[model samples]
Target: MAEVRPAFDEAARTHPPLREASSARQDAHPRQIRDDDLAYGLERVLDGLAARLEA
Candidate 1:
């Protein structure tokens, strides 16, 4: 059986421009998961749970 490398490697080899475009997009919009954002989400979930429990 042939060795199967990662799909990403195959894609990178097949289409170099696609890799460059993806890298550019990542650089443009980096992941910014701030603590405040997580806290806000947790607060919303807790509020929802409290409402459900009270209902």
Candidate 2:
């Protein structure tokens, strides 16, 4: 129960911070995200995830 409590509390605290960060980003100018940039970002994210999973 003690171990679980910390995990739950951490998640609760983290959620608000993430939401705030996202809100801040949303408040900024909406730039045109090019398809090439989207593809590059997705590839980088997937590659990082794959490397972590393989480790």
Candidate 3:
């Protein structure tokens, strides 16, 4: 793998701090998670399993 320092410095013009990186990721994927999404996903998985068993 390529050394990361050179590309990182070129991108940030200095060593980017942890706060900047964390904030970028958090902004891209907000933390306000919903239980409804999880439940819906689980329901789909269980439904698939039930269908397979019936087959």
Candidate 4:
């Protein structure tokens, strides 16, 4: 859970729609950051799980 929450917070912070809704309500931004976060977070989570399995 600790590992996951940072990932989720990072994704939430970078999500284009949420950014727009909160501050830049008149603009649209790319979702690349969020996508990258998703990939990175998934990789980290899977790696952690795999390490636990190996232990």
Output the number of the lDDT-best candidate.
4
Residues 1-44, model 2: lDDT tens digits: 44554565566575987656544544344353345458889999
Write one digit per residue (lDDT tens) for candidate 4, span 14-55: 687764554432222347546766899999999999999999
**Pairs of colliding residues, candidate 1:** none
TM-score of each predicted structure versus truth = 0.41, 0.40, 0.40, 0.46
lDDT per model vs. reference: 0.62, 0.64, 0.60, 0.65
The best candidate by TM-score is 4
After superposition, candidate 2 runs with Cα above 4 Å error: 1-33
- Choose 1 or 4, whichever is better by TM-score: 4
For candidate 4, which ten residues in a row score worst on lDDT?
21-30
lDDT for each residue of candidate 1 in 22-50, tens digit (9 for 90 to 100): 55544232334355457889999999999
RMSD of 4: 12.4
Q: Where in model 1 is the C-alpha error above 4 Å?
A: 1-33
- Extract clashing residue pairs from model 4: none
lDDT, candidate 2, residue 35? 55
